[model samples]
Target chain A: MKKFLSLHSLLSLICLLLVANNIKYLFVFIMSRQKVLNEVYYEPGYQFHTFLPHLKGVEKAGYITDLSVNRESNDGAYLQAQYYLAPTILELEDINYPYFIIDSKNTDFIIRTIKETKARRLANNEYGQALMKRPAP
Target chain B: MITIGYFLSFLLGRLTLDRCLKENVRLLHPCAAALLALVSGLGLSALLTFLTFVVLDSFHRPVIILVNISAIIIFLFFNRNLYIQKTIIPITDWLPWTKFRWFHFLYILLGVFIVGVAYVIALTHPYGEWDAWAIWNLKTRFLIVSDSWNLIFTDLHYHTHPDYPLLLPFINTWIYCFSADNLHPIPMVTNIIFVIGCGGFLCCTLYQIRKFSFPFLMGLIMFTTPSYLYLGTFQYADSLIAFFLLINLYFITMFQKTKDASWLNILGLSLGLTAFVKNEGLLMALILMFVVSVYILIDKNNRVGKSAVKHLLFTFLITFIPVLIFKVFIAPPNDDILPNINTSNFTAERFQILYNAVITEIFHEKWCYMWIVVLALLISRIWRAFNRENIILSIFFIIYSSAIVCIYVLNGKADLSWWLETSLSRILFSLLPALVFFGVHLHYSKQRGAHV
Candidate 1:
C-alpha cells in the first residue's frame, strides 16, 4: 500500500534526516497552534528571488548552502566575488562583479577543501560563480 | 569512489558510442569507439565528484533527502537484476565508433556549425536570460578548481535553485584541465557541445523512429526552437539535462520491449546523469522509474523482482548521500523559503489563502491555453493506443508529459504566471521534442506529408 512513497521517500527521509541533522527546508512550517519542542531553521528571512526568471542562471538562489575549493598553485589560487548590498543570497549575481573579490580566510581551509566546489557554484556554470577556490596560474 | 564514477561514466559513454556506431556502422572506425568510450567514461565519473557542492550548495543534503529516497523507491518498484556487464543492446549499444561514412562527418559538422554560430553571438551579446550568466556558466568558472565549498553561501543566499544534476561543468573541466588553463568562455564551448549533441541525437532518434524526413523536420524544429537555442548558447543546465533526457528516453524505449539488462544500466546511468544535471530532474526521473517499475512488476516471469532491492539501495545511497551530507550536516539551513513555511509576515492562514488564490487565479488563468491544448492532444493519442505507434506515442504522451506537469505542479515555484509565460513552456519544452517526435512518427504511418 505504501508503494515506498515514490522517489521522494528518500527526500522525506532526508527531510526527516534534515531535522535530525539540524538542517532546514523552506517547506517546514507550523502544522498547528502547538509549537514543536525543537525545529531546524529554514531561514525565514529569504524571499522568493524576484530576478530568478530574468537571471536565468539557476532554479533558485540560496538553494545551495556551502562551498569549498582548492587549487594546487598560488597564482591560480585567487578568487573573484561580488557580494550584494542587502545580502539575501539571491542578489549575488546583481552585485558589481569584476567589482569584488573573496577568498577563504585560511590557506589550511583552502588545502583541506582542495577541488571541492559548492554545489550551487557547480550548477551555475563557470563564470557565474562569485566565490571561488583556485590554483596558481 | 572516483574510479568507480569514472568506470561507470566511461561504460555509459561506451554504450552511447556503440549505439551511435551501430546507427552508422559504415562511418565508424573501431578506434573511434575507444575514443568515445574514453571521453564518455572519464567525462561522467569526473562529473560526479566535480558535482560535490560545486554546483549546488546543499548538494549532499538535498540529494540524500530528495534524490536517494526517490531512487530507492524506483529500485524497489522496478526490482529486477542481472549482470549488467554481460549484456548489451546491439542497436543501442555495441557500436563501432572507428568506422563511419563521410555523411556522418558532414552531419556532425552541420551540428557544430549551428551551435558554433549561436555561441559566437552569445560571446558578444552577453544577452542572456540573467540565470545563464548569473547562475550556471558563471558559477561553473568559480567552481572549476574551487577549494572552499562555504563561499557559495556568502554570495547566493536564497534567490535561485542551483542544484541541477548535469555533468556539463565537469565536461568543461575536462577540457580546461586538458588545456591546463582557465579561460573565459571555456565553459561556453562545453555548453555548445551540449546543445549540438541534443540536436544531433534528436535527429538520430527521429531517423530511427520514422526515417530521414521526420528526423529532418525534428532537427529543424529543435534548431529553431526559440528559448532553447539561446538557453543553449550560454552555460545553463537545461541543454545538458535535455541531452540526458534524450538518451534516457531512448534507452527506456529500447529496454522496455527487449528486456535488455544494459538498458536498465542505461536507465540507472541516465537517471544519475539527470539528477546530476538538475534537481528537478530527480523528480521527473523518479516518476518515470515508478512507471517502469509498474511495468516490470507485471512482467510474466517476475524477472525483475529479485534484484530490484539491491539496486534500489545502491542507487539511493549513491545518489542521496552527497546531497544529505551537504544540506543537513555540514552547512544546515541558513536561508531560503519553503512552500509550506510561513515566511510571509502574514499569519499561517495566509498560506492557504495564498495557495488557494494561486491555484485559482494564476494556475487556472486563461492565457495559458497552450499547455492545455498540448495536454489534450497528448491524451487523445493515449486514448487511441491500439497499434505499435499508438502504444509508443501513448507512453511518451501520458507518462513523460504528465511527469513534468506533475512535478511543476508539486514543486510550484513563485510567480506562477511568469513561470507559465517564460519557464513552464521550457519545462514543457523538454518533453515537447520527444512528444513531437513521437507524434510525427505516428502521424506519418497513416498520412502523406513529409515532416522533415
Candidate 2:
C-alpha cells in the first residue's frame, strides 16, 4: 500500500481526477460538433479571396456588413477588418443599409436570411459579398 | 517531399550534434527520437521560412519550397562529418508486448482513451477556438493566397494581429501547399501535430531519464492541464511556444547533467524557435541569455567559463538572427501595448490591483492546477531547489515571471483588468511545461538522492 502513494501514483491520482472532468469537455464538443444548421448555394462570381488587394469594393458596398459565420456567431474580425483594412467611404445615410460578406462555407440560415431580405447577391464562389435591399427599420 | 526534408534535416542535425544522441544513437529509443524529430522538423521549417522571406521579397510557394529543400541539403553537407551507421533502438524498446504487466495495460488503455477524447475535442471545433481562425489560420489564408504575404504586414485591421510572428502561418502555408491547397483540415491537423509533439516530448524525455511509469504520469499531468490541452487543440501559438520552451529546458538540463556542449546547440535552436513562435518568446529568449551568461560567469573554472560564455553567445547569435530580421524588416508595430505611459499612474493601488488579479488567477483552483502543482513542488523542495545547478533555472523562472508582470503593468492596453483576466492564464500556460519540468526534477532528485 505504501507503494501506491509513490510520486507517480499520487500524480496519476490527480490526473484521474482531471480526466474525470473530460466528460464535461466531451459533452461540449459533442453538442457543438455540427456547426452548419442550414444549406445554401454560392451567389456566383465568388472566386476565392486570393488577397484583399484593395478595399475599394468593400468601401463602395457600405459599412457595417455582417461577416463570416461559424454556427451561431458572427465573425468578429469582419467589423475590425472593415474599419482598419477597408474603411467605407459611402454616404452616411447608406451606413444603415444591411449587407453581408459571407464565408464560402455559408449556412442555410445566412443564405435564407439574405433571400428573405431580397438582398442583391453580388459575388458568391468561395468568399461571398451581398447587399441587402432593405435596411432594418 | 519538401516537408519530409525538413524532418530529415533536423534528425541529421540532432544525431550529428547532440552528444546524448551521438553517444547513444544505437541505444536511443524510438519514441524519444520521434518527439525530437517533430520539434526539430517544425523548428527548421520556421527557420527556413523566415530565412527565405528575408532573402527574397516574394512569397511564392515554389520559391519557398526550393529554399527549404536547399537549406536541408546545405545543413546535411555542413554536418556530413558527424554522420555514422548507428542503428536506432527498435520499436520493441517503446512497445515491449512480451512483458504483460497489469499497470502497463492500464497505462496503455488510459493513453488511448485520452487521445481519443482529445481528438474528438479537436474535431468538435473544426476551425479551432477563436484565435486559431481569427489569428493563426487567418494568417495562413493570407500566406497561401497568391500575392497576400504583403497583406500580412499591411495596415489592415490589426485584428489579424499583424505584428505577431509568422512561424505558424508559414508552416500552415507549407502544409496547405503540400496538401494542394486543401485548406479545411490542414490547420486543424497541424495543431494536432503540435499537441502530439508537446505531449510526446514531455513523456519521452522524462522516460529516458526516469523510466516509464512516472514519466507517463507526468505526460498525463501535462496533457490533463486544461489550458494546455484546450489551447493545443485550439491552434494557439501558446501551445507551440510551450513545446519549444520545454524542449529548450530539456536540452539545458541535459547539458547540466552531461556537461555536453553539443546540448547547447539544441538549447539554442529550441530557444530561438521559441522566439519565432511568439512575441513573449522573444522576452523568454532574452531572459535565458542573460541568465545563462550569468551562470557561465559565476563558475569557478575561469578558462572553461570564458569559453562556455563565448560558445553560448555564438549559439544565441546564430539562432536569433532570423528572429532579428523578422522583427526589424517585417512585422508591423505592436498595437497591444499602450502608446505612452504615465509615470505617475504607477501607484500602489495599481500595483495591488494588478498583483492581486495575477495571483488570484494563477493560484485559483479552477483550470490552473499546473501552477498549484508547481507551487506545491517548490514548497516541498525549497531546500533542495537552492542548489548550484538549480540556481540558474530558478533565476530564469523568477526573472521571466517578473518580466511578464512588468509587461502587464507598464504596457497594458486601456482595458487593463480585462486583458489581465483573459490573457494572463493563457500566457502563463505557455510556461506550464517548465513548471512541470521543475516538479519532475524535484521528484527525481528525491527519489534518486541526487541533484537534478
Best candidate according to DockQ: 2
- Tens digits of per-residue lDDT, candidate 2, B60-144, equal 6677667666766765665444444324333243334565568766656765766675676676566666667667766666565
Model 1 TM-score, all chains together: 0.54
What DockQ does predicted model 1 obtain? 0.04
User: CA lDDT of B152 in candidate 2?
Assistant: 63
Q: In candidate 2 chain B, what residue range of length 10 has the lowest lDDT sum?
A: B85-94
Per-model DockQ: 0.04, 0.14
Which residue pairs clash within candidate 2?
A: A38-A108, A46-A125
lDDT string for model 1 (B349-428, tens) is: 43454445434532342312323433443454553454542353355446655544443344333443444444543454
All candidates' TM-scores?
0.54, 0.77
Model 1: number of backbone collisions: 113
What's the true lDDT of residue B353 in model 1?
A: 41
